[model samples]
Target: MVSSDSQYSYTSSSDTELYSPAADIEHPSYISKILSKTKPDEGKARKSIAETHAEGIENTLTRYESSTHGIGPIESVLDEEKPEQFDVKPDTELNEWDPWHYPVDSETGFRIVQFVDNDRDDPRCWTTRARWNYTILLGLVCFDVAMMSAIITGDMKSPAAHFGVSLEVMCLCVSLMVWGFGLGPLIFAPFSEEFGRNRVYQTTLLVAVCFIIPCGAATNIGMLLAFRFLDGVAFSAPMCLIGGSLSDMWRNEERGSAMAIFSVAPFLGPVMGPIVGSLLSVKCSWRWVYYFMIIFSGCLYGVMFIFLPETHHQTILQRRAKKLRAKGDSSYRAISEIKTRSVKKIAKDTLLRPIILLSELIVFLVTLYMAVIYGLLYMFFFAYPVVYGEGKHWGDIKTSLMFIPLGAGTILGTLAAPFLNKDYVKRAKKYIDRGQIPPAELRLIPMMIGCWFVPIGLFAYAWSSYPHISWAGPAFSGFSCGFGFMMLYNPANNYIVDSYQHYAASGLAAKTFVRSMWGGAVPLFTIQMYHRLGYEWASSLMAFISLACCAIPYLFYIYGARIRERSKYAYSPVQGELKDPEQGIDSSAQDMRSNHQLSERVIDNE
Candidate 1:
C-alpha cells in the first residue's frame, strides 16, 4: 500500500470532473442493468466509498451524479466509467502542460508527474553564486561535525586515566565513533531523500551536539562510548549528503573548483581537531574537549540555521505541489510525489540501497579505494602521535603541529583544480561550440590522473620518516599524501555525484558506509600493526595495496562509459538528452547552457 501526504492525494475514477470515460455509446445489458438499479443500499454502502466527489463531478456527467444517488447504483457505472488516463492537476488547462498523462513506467511501478520546463522555483534553477554559498554553508556544517572525531585522538592517555578504564577500551570510544559514521548514513541518506537535506542537517547535528555533552560529563567508559557512537552517527551526515548537495548546485563541468573547496571540510575538521585538541589537552583536560565542541557547534548551528536553504529540487517541488493543492489546484502534483511507499517498504529500500549500490562495480571499486585511503588516514590518527611524539620525542603541541603539513599539502593540492578540470572545461566547450552535450565520463579525467599520486605519496611518506631524518622530510612527505589524496578524492567523489545524478545522495551514502567502515576498523589495530610491522613496512604495505588499486581509475577511464551504461542508478543520456523523469526536463538544454558558460570562461582566458 502506498502512503501519501495530505497534499498528495489519489482521486477516484468516479470523479469525472478530472476524467470521464467515453460517452455516446450503447451500453451492454450487464452494464445497463447495473447502472439502471434504483433500489440503492444507502444504509449499508454509505460507509465504504471509493472516491470523494467534487461539486463539478455532479454537473459534468451522469456517471458522477450517482455519488448523491448512493454508491450502490453508481458502483458499476464508476467501474465501467474508469478513464484510460488521469489529469494530475485540474485547475490549469491540460493543454498548458506538455505530455499530460504520465504513464506508469515498469521500473518505478507508478506514473510520474514532471515539470514541463525548468521551473524557476526549482533549486536547480538558482543562480550559481547563490548555489555555491549554500554549498559552503553545507561544508561548514560537515566540518563542524567531523572536527569532533579528532578531538580525543591527539591525547587519549589522560581520558583513559580520568575514566578509570583500560586505555585500549577507552580509545575504542573514538574507533566506535568512527563506526557510527558508517551506520548513520544507512538511515540519514534515505531520510534525506524522503524529506530533504536541510532537515537531516538540523536534526542530526543537534542530536550529535547533545551526545557530546554527555561525553564531557560521562561517569564511565560505557557512557562515553555510547555517546561517541551516537555522535559519529550524527556527524556522518556531511559525508553522505554534501557530495549530493554539491552535485545539485553545479553542472559537472563547473563542480571542480567547488568540489576542491568542499572536499576540504573532511580534512579541515580532522586537522583542526588535532591542533585544537592538543592545545586543550595540554591547557585544560579531556572534558574540556567536549566543552570546546559545545561552543563551536552552538555557534555553527546558529549560522547554518540562518544561511542553509533546501537545495533538492524534488523537495522544493513537493512543497510547491502542496501549495498548489491549497489554492484548489488539486491536480497539480510533482513527479516525485507519485511514488509513495509504506513505512515498511521505505525502511526496506532505505536499508537495502547502500548494500545494493555496493554491488555495482563502479561503486564497489571506488568505495574500496576510498575506504583504503580513509583507513590509512584513520590509522594516522594513531600513527601521527606515535611517529612524532614517541618516535621523535616531541611534546603534545609539536606533535599536533606535525599535522599541519598534511593540511598544507591538501590546501596546495587545491591548485590542481583548474588543471584537473581542464579536460572537462575543454570537452564541454567543444560540445557547446558544436551544440552538443559531453559524455558523463568527462568528469573522471582528473580523477584518473589523481589516482596515480596516491601510491606515490604513500611510498614517499613510508620511506622518508626515520629516527635520523629531519622532521621536515616526513612532514613534506605528508604533503604528498595530502596532495595525492586531493588528486584522487575530489574527482572520485565528483564522478559518483555526476554519474548517479538524482541518486547522488544514496551513492555517497554507499561510499560513506564503505569509507567509514574501513576508517573505523583501521584504528582498532593500527598501533598493533605498527608494533608488529614497524612504520616503513606498514606504510609501504598500504602503498602497495594502493598501487594495486591504481588500475581502478585507469580502467574506469577506459571503460567507465560502458560500466555506467549498465548501471540502473546512472542517469546517462538516452539518445542525446539526459532525462530527468522527475522534472520532465531534458538536460540537453541545461548542458548546452553550462557548456556555453565554459566556452566563455575559455575565451576570456585565451
Candidate 2:
C-alpha cells in the first residue's frame, strides 16, 4: 500500500536538537484543548489558513503573510545573529497581490514553508518523463531484488554436489536469504526514514553486490549460505523502499500505472530467475549464477547512484533548511525539524502495532491466504524440478523452460490489473454518489475472481504429471497459477490497507512478515513432500489446500464490514462521513508524519 503523503519519519537537523529541552516541547504557541489535532475542521469549519489560525502570535513572519495585515514579500538577512533576527518587512510600494508565502499559523507562531499550488519543488510536479524514468528504474530494481532470491534455485544440484551436501542443505541458500528479506526491513525501513531513500538504496545495493562475490567464490556451504543471507539482507532495502519511492513521485490518481510496474516485478523477476540461471549454469558453471548477479546488481547500483535524486519530502526539506542555515538564515525551518518521533515511539509503531493487528480476523485470514499463495510460489521453484527432472528424467534447461508459462501468466495478470482497478473505481462511485466511503470489501472483488485459478492450475498440474504425458499439460497449468498469484496478492494488500486506514502500514508489515517466513520455509520441505507423496498426490495436496483458500475472499467480501467494525485498528467509516478521495486522511503535519513512518514499513515481502 502506497502512502499518498511524501514524509517518512522525522529526524533532527542538528544533533543538539535530539537532547535539547526544546525537543521535548510540542508546538509552543498552538494548543487546542478539545479539538482533534491531527484532523482538519469538519463540514462548514473548513477554511483558509488565515481564517483558521486567527489567534496566532504577533510575529514578523505572521504579520507579513496574514491576509488582514496585507501581503508583502519576505526579506531575510543572510548574515544574521539569530533566526529571529531575519525580520519580515512590509513593502507596500511593491504590493502586486502575491499569494501567501512562508505562511505562519496564528496559534503556533511557527512558519511552516509549504509547496504552493503547482509548486515546482513538489515531486508530483516533476516532468512526466522524469517521473517515469525513476518509476521504471525503481521497478527494475524491485525485479532485480526479487530475481536474486530465486536465481539460486535453478542449479542447486551442481552447488549441492560441489559442497558435498544434500540438495536439502542447499535449499538453505533460498530459505535463509528469504528470512533476511523479512528481518532486514525491520532495520532498513526505519533507517530510510533517517537517511532518506537514495542513500539507503545506493548503500544496500552496493553491499548486496559485494556479498554476491563471496557466494560465487565460497569454498564451503557455510560461507555460501552466510553471504547469501547477507546479500538478502542488503537487497531487502530496495524491496521495502520502492513502494514509498513510487508514492513520493506520483499522486493517487497517477499512481496506478506506476505501481503496476512495481506489482509485476516481484512475481515476474522470480519467474525469470530460474530461466536465466539454468542457461548460465548449463553453459558455464553454477558459480556463474552468482557472478551474473554481481555484474547485474553492480550495474544497477551504479545507474541508481548517478540518477536517483532524494525524493523523500522530510529529507529534502531538511537539506533545504540546512542550506538556508549555512548562509546564516536559520529562520527557515522544515516540519521535520519541528516534529519528530522518539526511538521509543518508533519502536512501538513498527514492532508492537503489527503484532497486535494480526489478531484481527481480517488481518489473520488475509495474511494466511497470502502466505499460502507465497508458499505456493516458492513451492513451484522446487516442485518444477521434481515434476519434470525426476519424474520424466528431464535436464535442468528443459525444466526451466516450463517456468515461462508461469511468467507469462503473471504478466497477463499484471496487464489485467488496469482493468481490475477500473472496475474498482466504477464500483466505488456508487458509494461515493451516496456520500459514503466505499467499503473495504470492494477490494476483495478481484480476489474472489482470482481465487479459483490456483486450484484449477494445481489440479491440472497434478493429474497431468505422468511420465507418458506431454510436457504441455503440467507446464501450461502455471499460466492460471501465475495469474491467480497477482490477482490475489495485489487485492489482498489493498484490502488490508483499506481495512486499516491509519494503521495500514502495520497491517501490511504483519502480512509481509508472515508470508515471507512461510515462503522461505516452503522450499525446504517441498522436495521431500514431492518424493514421499508422489507427484500427483503432492501436487493434489497443495491444490486441495488452495481450494480451501478460495473461501477466504468470499468469506471476507460478505462479512468484512462487520469484522472491521469490531476490529480495534480497522477503519470502518460510517455512512455519509466526509472522506477525501485523494488524501484519505486529514491533511495535518502530525498525520503526515505518522503516515510517513507507517508507509516506510510497507516492504515488498515477496
lDDT of 1 by residue, 1-606 (tens): 121332222223342332211322222222222233455474322211111111112112221111111000111122333221232222222221222222222233333333322334545557777887787777777677677887688788888888777656766877888888778766565566567778877888788878889989998888888899988878776566665566556655566677666667777678778788878988998789899998888778777777878765567657865765565445545544653446665554456665777878888898888888777767767887777777788877788887888888778777777775676768765754554556566766776676676678777777776767788866677777777777777667656655654344345557766677788878778777766888788788988998998888788778877878888876565446444435533455553343233221111000
Please tell me which predicted candidate would have the highest TM-score against the true structure: 2
Across 219-273, the per-residue lDDT of candidate 2 in tens digits comes to 9999999998898888887888787777777766677788788889999999999
TM-score for model 2? 0.82
**TM-score of every model versus the real structure:** 0.71, 0.82
lDDT of 1: 0.62
Best by lDDT: 2
